[model samples]
Target chain A: MEGLIDGVLPDAAELPGLVADLRTARSGISFVYDVIEKLAERYELSDAVMVLDHPELGRQAFRSARRPIGEASAMHLNVLECPEGVHGVPGGVDPVSASVAVELCRIALDLDLYRHDSRHDGLTGLYNRRFFDVMFRRCASQSARYGWSFSVVIFDIDSFKQLNDRFGHMLGDRVLQVVGAEMHHALRSSDVAGRVGGDEFAILLMRADRENVPAFMSRIRAAVEANMEMSVGFSFGIAEAPVESTDPAELYRLADARLMAAKGTKR
Target chain B: MSVPASSEEVRLAPLGDSGDEDESPPFDALELEIRRLPGVVAVGWHRGEAMRACLSVGGFGLSALRSRAVQLARGHLDEPLSVELSDVEGVFAASSVASVRIIDILVAGGEVEVRLGAGHLIGTGRAGTGPEGAALATIRALDDLGIGASIELRIASAVVLPSDLGLAVVVSVVDRHDGSEHRSIAYASSVEESAAKAVIEAYELIGEQSRDQAQSAIR
Candidate 1:
């Protein structure tokens, strides 16, 4: 493949094709993998690594290698503002085309980020109601098909309107943000949490029933207490599928009814 | 699905549709479509509560954007979605005016001094402290520039939006010759600065309205 790079700037001819590939990339990791594959094929490099700075994901390194190695080569191709450069690039590569390729990679990452932002709540960083419902249905379908069990929890901040009226909405928003962060930290990757309403939250726990929920709630409470300056309290209701009901809407209603009962006892 | 077509009806709409296989999310497409409507500057869910769209001054496509926003939000939200349409013409228009600039503002003891600059031209005014005083100083500075006679500016209110949304100052200026009130809301990090800009934008709005009225009369 050394003959492919024999020209003064052979990579310049590859720019358009690289851009088209970047355009069709589904995610940043896949795009980096494709770039590494292309570099390996075009330049006969055994390995490649790309270090990227993303607004949301921060700094991350993606690596591709033909075989397990003790150490990667030290060569770097400077791309965009990535002064650290893309490591493992061969010496003969064109700087101009390499920079353009990296820039296209950056734009592709941004497009994915926008796609993510749309599905999440801006203030709390949880799945918004719309996306949450979609995910919930998928989980429910899987459970029904395979006879797996899961639990649904619905809860809201107690006397939240009073809290907003007394302390103002800024403090109220702060409480919500802190609670959201706590919920995000408390749940496992398989579990999903969403901001279903103002000061309201819902969680879907996979492979778990109501019996396994208190520990998760305790973790959220502990985190909230550790992070927040003010005392913020909430009530929750949990119902398990197959044990409670198979219907998704019925599960939510059961959880909500229990939530109302819990709130009633608190008062 | 068919959305409620009532142009004034505002309801809670959900976020994005994840079913889309497109590169960009549906929320972004909705936002882009709304922004493309005449006079819209920004569109988003207001802190995950309501859909809020900010419109530019003299913008004409409110009804169109409102309906589209409702349609876009239909399946994404389950609650009563309130669509908030705020006129941001005053704050945004001041930035895009090209000529005018608020050079300096000094509040000392019981008085305030304001300096207005447009290219090489400068105007100065002094008044008492507070938003009303800020508006007074701005009008005086405009008078110094030989442009204040067309309207009489007054400070209406300087208030903060909930959840630290920022401070906004409302200025109601009367077209002295025509006896019509032109109310403008300008937002800034500080109340005094918002008041100063609100007064200036109200003046600009009055000038545009008068020109429009004159053209209409001629036609």
Candidate 2:
């Protein structure tokens, strides 16, 4: 591994395969860090960091940098367990160094952000439709493994178009922001809420029964109604995960159809 | 003996000056009377619509009352029913009707005044036609009765489907002064019913008031 790092930067084509090998080996965190550090040293790079998902410590990264004089500088990266990873450089560097370093850091950070964003809505910053698909499968798999149940709730703004017309687009944006915040506040930490479309949101309730859904939805509805601008309310449709459908896509379609049914009956 | 009895007829003065009075102050005799109506639970007054009242009733009659109120209002103001208006001018022209909902109920005297109004349309389903028809209907309804006149209808407690509980009773009254029309709807229901009924009754009350006023003026 040291010899591998001492050579030229891993070919762009080969880096993925090498990373896969490292992952498969279940390489120790220190070993991974050393590999990154040695590579940075060989390339005369400013810095390198290796992060791992640890059972007890969450995600922690060990970073090593090579000074212009070839001395080793090191730091420990501490971050929350949020789905996306955070990155920043400390102290001041010259503009050129800063630009290059920042761009490099962004490239690394973006890998994580993109992974999370793929599962989240860009505008509302809630979980995206893709996230729902992924979560359905993951949750179903977990439920099958654990012999538990999972449920989903599909909610959309009732007559949201009227709101945009009466209050204008800016207020409509405010409404979404307020709704997202309230929903986040309403759910347990274990639960997941994602914005799947312009006015559509979905929630994944772990270990939830069909009976528990109405109460959960009622709480969410009340919270949203109370927190939102005057007279705004939402309609929701709920479906249990494996019970509704084993397939993730089918589960979503079922939930969405139920939501449309609820909307149709509203006078 | 002839000087003992004076011929002068002493008439009681009206509560306030007839002109420029706050027609629907927060608390007044009429407001109190509305609150005391049969089945009424709460009453509020606003100058914009005037005499908003609410009532809670035992039974599906509320829907019938809603249609009847719209009909009676049309007789006086010549404005069509909300559904009819929606069809003719498109739903947006009569958008105000959809905004009304029953909020609460109050019973005062022997009259059962259903309180209605409050809430707004969730979205813009209609075009921009303004409130001409709604305004005209309100003016006509208010013009009909002499001073202290009131109307009552039986209302069934409303039930939002999929939910078992009865929500509330809703009603509205409209009156005219000069050329301007004043209309109000009151709701008499529990806190649970507040969100659904407030918007429905407001529109009904406005339409009813406009028609009543227009008819009275014609007479």
lDDT of each: 0.59, 0.39
- Model 2, C-alpha of A185: deviation from truth (Å): 2.4
Which lDDT tens digits does candidate 2 get at residues A138-169?
Answer: 77677657656777888887788988777655
Off by over 4 Å in 1: A1-24, A46-73, A76-89, B1-219
lDDT of 1 at B97: 26
Which residue pairs overlap in candidate 1's backbone? Answer: B11-B81, B12-B80, B12-B81, B13-B77, B14-B76, B14-B77
Kindly provide the TM-score of model 1 when superposed on the true structure, using C-alpha atoms: 0.50
Tens-place lDDT per residue, model 1, B1-219, is 111213332221222234244323434443433333333433334333444433232233345445545543442333334455654433222222223468778776687777775422346777887788888888887766432245676445877778967778898988777789888888876777788899888876765565455445444
Error of 2 at B26 (Å): 56
Per-residue lDDT over B100-210 for candidate 2, one digit per residue giving the tens place of the 0 to 100 score: 223223222322222222111011111111122222222222212111123232222333434555433333323222233333332333422332233234434554454
lDDT, model 1: 0.59
Q: Could you tell me the lDDT of residue A219 within candidate 2?
A: 68
Worst 10 residues of 1 chain A by lDDT: A65-74
Q: Scoring model 1 with DockQ, what do you get? A: 0.02
> What is candidate 1's CA lDDT for residue A36?
56
Highest DockQ, which number? 1
